[model samples]
Target chain A: MKEETIINFTHHQTAHCENGVVSNLMKHNGFSVSEPMVFGIGSGLLFCYIPFLKVNHAPVITYRAMPGHIFKKFAKRTGIKMKREKFSNPKEAQSKLDENLERNNPVGLQVGVYNLLYFPDEYRFHFNAHNMVVYGKQDGRYLISDPVMEEVTSLSEKELEKVRFAKGAFAPKGHMYYPISFPEKLELEKAIVSGIKDTCKTMLAPIPIVGVKGIKTIANLIRKWPKKKGIKTANHYLGQVVRMQEEIGTGGGGFRYIYAAFLQESGKLIGNEKLIELAKEMTEIGDLWRDFAVEASRIYKNRSRNDAGQSENYNQVANQLDHIADLEKVFFKKLKKAI
Target chain B: MKKEEVPQDKSNLESANFRELCYAIDENGEYTTANSTGWEPKTVALNNAIDEINDRIEDAKKRVLEGKTSPIEYHMELHKMDVGILASYVGLWQWRVKRHFKPSVFKKLKMNTLQKYAEVFEISVDELKTIK
Candidate 1:
């Protein structure tokens, strides 16, 4: 029997793929940072319900920032350096990855979420920007640490290449990244303050596409959907909203809970009790988001629940979201003063 | 959002094929974690996506039977794609993919092109040529 050939890599199942990949990469470089800390330093918390933009013919609603932005922000905040490369040709990309693996380098890659065969069919979509680490090759299959998976998995070279070069909607173009260096020690004081301010700016942005206003916009959109698209079609939209929020990439309550964990960790790192209290408030806000998902899902389940009851459910969701928005608003404001 | 309403069915949570742990608040507003088997709210999302693909497949099958479109069309819809998306995956242009959607063009397509589409759908070319 052929023996297994996996580079020394620790697999950690994290709430978000980008956070997990970045954290794992840092750990590979001897920097011990938690997933939540990576997420926070990257400033992964934000909201935008852009009706103008569409994915798979539906309006786009992103709970987190754009792909690769978080990793860039994290590196900017912490003094870590990484080498990221994208290949135009799949053959060259394959050779580069093989060369890296031959040197025992565990490389991170960008892949489409849909073509990953190991993923449940129900969970697959046309999303083309999922992140994972490729650590080894054995018998023409690649060992992978997909942060969203419960365990490390392996895929054939053909399967990996298909996902890596998946077309349409944020094509990865064979992108790969790994840290080149890490500072002797991480002084998170400046990084924490900067991350908090970054989040605050996103939350407070007056543009209609994002932040508190975006929540209100989505609520209003959901309220009108039942009337606009009819109950059945509207239910599909609602299902997709929560799916984007929670289903894709360990999303539970739109990463609000993850952000809370970051705040708690950051609080401890800075030794500020008030930040920890703020973390509690953020957790409560995360619950409010989950509450919206539950009520919205209930509405989706009840197709014939009548317009009045349906309207009431949507109103409750909108009201809860608004409440959550207010809480985050205050939370960021207080966070600014806290630090 | 009443914390009480959050599910706590230990059996279901444990028996679920794939469960995820999400950091959440407990009933006491404490920072307690929850083990979600992705059973409740996520099921609604999962079922909806499945239904959408099934509906598309049904429509594509109907079109293929009526000779209005080719199996390539059905296969594309089965994979939940449009002309532009398929074009990108197959390294073809949008106009060409639109042309290939016709039964006449798809029937005359060379083995190389058919192989590309087959690899995308992860099926044999014979399967791609014939309706299942």
Candidate 2:
């Protein structure tokens, strides 16, 4: 029998997977980083509507930056060195993971969500951008630290490999990453400012398919979906939007709440009252998002609704989204000036 | 959203035995993390998506029973994958994947091709050959 190896890794449940994994890894490395800090410093927020791309038969709407972007940016801004490796061969990937465990290193991995047996059944889908950490190997089962989960779990060798190499859009392809080096002291203030600036620029970008413009574009689509796609398809599209906003792990309200928390934390740290005030405004915007979701879901829930009723509900939801877009536009502009 | 206002609506997450962590402002006007049982709107959207997938699975099963398509279609839906995604996993072209949907074409497929599909679904070649 092979010897067992387990690193002393602390599991911290977090709102989103990527940020949680990054923060947990930092804690393991003797750096106490909060999830919001990781999210903010990594500039993890975004709103992109990719009408050309399809996921689960609906146009893709993402609430966060692309997978691995957070860790990549966090490492770059803080002068931390990260080692990311992808393997074409499953055998080599498993061996490399085992090697890391033997060396007492907990490795972060990007895996598909569908085959995560430990995940809640309702949450398992064909999403391929989920992140987790493997901290040890014991009796042919790997110890998993999925930050979104409440507790640590274990997966057998086959189960682990299947998700590690799960195939599809944004397929993990046996991707593994971990921090290799850290500076003697991280420049937190500089990193925070840079991250905030990057987010402000992205959120205020002039592109129609992204940023604040993207939110309005979605609002426009929501208004037309009922007439153009019929009630069945339109409701499905609306449900898709809500799922992307809330179900796919945004800490509720499509990451707005998370960003507000980030601003609040950074405001206290940087001694900026303006940012603290703006965080309250952001929270209100988040409440508006939740209201939009609730209103949209009402349309899809009442399947036997008359055409007139359905269209009115759609209009209301679309109006709510437009309001959110406007609020976010003004909020980002104010945040930009505050920073 | 305020800390006390965080929704614990007792949705699908209750069955999953977990609560989602959410960010909220406390009474003191400070940011805090709170655990939510679930939210109603999220639960509705999640159930809708799952129901849609189940509906597709049922349709695929009907086609398989009528012998209008191969077991591959049923298994594909059961595994929560589309033809394009399944094609990528099996290293087959999209046209070939659609062609294999026909019972006759799937029957003529060789062991190697069958092995590829079976590997993807994590089932044996024999299991891939027949509907359960």
Candidate 3:
């Protein structure tokens, strides 16, 4: 293997190990455990097999939003009927919005109420609901532009029309319109877990063999042995030497370059001792990513209760994977410099 | 009771003298019926009596334009006779025009200057087309 590639793999392995520790710590706390769920599952399995995947800094929960159905379910479960009250008139809605604004709350916590009115030339079946997404404290309200889908793609307008016009409690078309088909809940959860595992594995690929004849020759000699037997023995021998080199390089010019870049981005500088402490703290990134993946997968699984599209599920997983990749890049760059 | 009757007698005599004075002014004609406070006829004096009525009308108009008056109150004052006359003043036309064209922009426009500008420019009726 090339020296840089071997070094990169070593860093990746170390990052994964650190992530595992952080995951355990997080589990010990009130937070959820990092199970082999979502894209993290495959990544976790790969890390278990390889000795080099490593990272720093446990992932922190940054953003979350309530899905439409989830919010509806929550309201139902709580028996909180969200009745549409007469807000005097359209003008009064603005005043109520203003009144709510004086109470200091996070922008995300604000409730947005909207009146869905259809305009001319729009499809009756695909009518866009005018929505208001209230945000900011100065009584500022922003209109949310996204629309909620009320029916499935398979159901025709005629079928929907019958539902809309249907009367009585037993009306099938109006009361319960299925938007998407869902798999068995357990099966859906398993699939989501498997997707997470695959993502993590892809992020930590095998170290490339080029440029360093010495390491490559050794790796080649090891390859001659049984695959499983050789990998374990080779990693053990290589890991020790790599660890020592990393320690020595910590005080060198490479460390200064990493620190300077980090300081510039963060707008905070630390002494060498503090920098070392931060570096140690960051070693938990892999574990945090694992936890994030597991939680995200669980959320997706819960969402599967209501029929959701394959593309929707895929998009959710893709977003988590993107976040994981971003974390990986930061960890790798730092580790590469440290080595 | 007798002492109370003496004060009553004095007031009655005073009222009698007042009635005689009214009669001396030819109160026997239709003017007699018109002279009583409640029975008074509507006259030109009634209109002229309210000297500051124009000012009150202007005030009410300004308040309505400023959004200080509720919709119900605005319509009520707008329909009032004296206030309606103030609506004829050049200032009211300017106020209405400024409110029509650019509400926020005209809100800052001085009342006096706006009235003068409307008169000098001969912009009648405060119509949207006339403002341009």
Of the candidates shown, which would achieve the greatest TM-score relative to the real structure? 2
Residue A178 in model 2: lDDT: 94
Summarize candidate 3's per-residue lDDT along A256-331 as a digit string, tens digits: 2222223222222212333243333332442333333343333333222333343344345345444544555455
lDDT of 1 by residue, A131-239 (tens): 9999998888999999877789999988898899999878999999988887779877898889888988888888777987788788778778877877777777888
TM-score of chain A of 1: 0.95
Clashes of each: 0, 0, 28
> Can you tell me the DockQ of model 3?
0.00
TM-score to native of every candidate shown: 0.90, 0.97, 0.16
Candidate 3 residue lDDT tens string, B7-119 = 11122112222110010012211111001111011111122212223344566556656655422223222223222222332335534643433545544656654554444
Q: Per-residue lDDT for A74-167 in model 2, tens only?
A: 9999999999899999999999999999889999999998888877787778888999999998888999998988889999989989998988
Instruction: Evaluate candidate 3 and give its CAPRI docking class based on DockQ.
Output: incorrect
What is the C-alpha local distance difference test score of each model? 0.80, 0.89, 0.26
Ranking by lDDT: 2, 1, 3
lDDT of 1 at A276: 88
C-alpha displacement of B39 in model 2, angstroms? 1.2
Q: Give me candidate 3's interface root-mean-square deviation.
A: 47.8
Q: Please tell me how candidate 2 rates in CAPRI terms.
A: medium
* lDDT of candidate 2 at residue A195, scale 0 to 100: 95
Ranked by DockQ, the better of candidates 2 and 3 is 2
